[model samples]
Target: MDGADYLHPGSEWAKEPDDIDSIDFSPTVTIMYFADDDTWQAVWGGREQLGEFEGTREEAIAWARERCNTIRIYSPSEGDIVDLVPDE
Candidate 1:
């Protein structure tokens, strides 16, 4: 299946299983900030937290489109949707 196949209804986007598996489990939305510098902050979610990840922004958008939903990427200016990645 493609990235679109994994999107959940009403959600902004979904990631392929490969990508989702890479993200560190968190209780909340992972937050990343960009200013003079870039910083990333992760929020852990409860066991009930449900979501997925994409390998790229385009994939994420496609997932969103498949679900008829819109995603807002977290940014300092207006926020931007981005594919979640695992921390090194």
Candidate 2:
């Protein structure tokens, strides 16, 4: 498989990569929208608490996307979405 295969949705690498067994994909930032506070907070890895933003969900995702490859965005009423933003 090619390098791009690693990023493909149904590619072998994306499925179950066997090449780098020791690699670790961790510390993915998570963005959550709080309706009470009317703010979007970017939490790092666990609950380290990165920063709060006064913008839309897309902006929060873009912010988290800039810091890490994987992101978990949560919405108050719409549930949550996990995204694996590929590195360019």
Clashing pairs in 2: none
51 Cα displacement, candidate 1 (Å): 3.6
Residues 15-70 of candidate 2: C-alpha lDDT, one tens digit per residue = 55555556554667756555655666666663345554546666776777777667
TM-scores, all candidates, are: 0.28, 0.47
Per-residue lDDT for 1-88 in model 1, tens only? 2323323433454433556666644444443333323333332233453455433445544443443222334433323435444321
Candidate 2 off by > 4 Å: 1-25, 46-54, 76-88
**lDDT agreement of model 1 with the native:** 0.39
| Worst lDDT 10-window in candidate 2 | 1-10
Could you say which candidate leads in lDDT?
2
> Whose TM-score is greatest here?
2
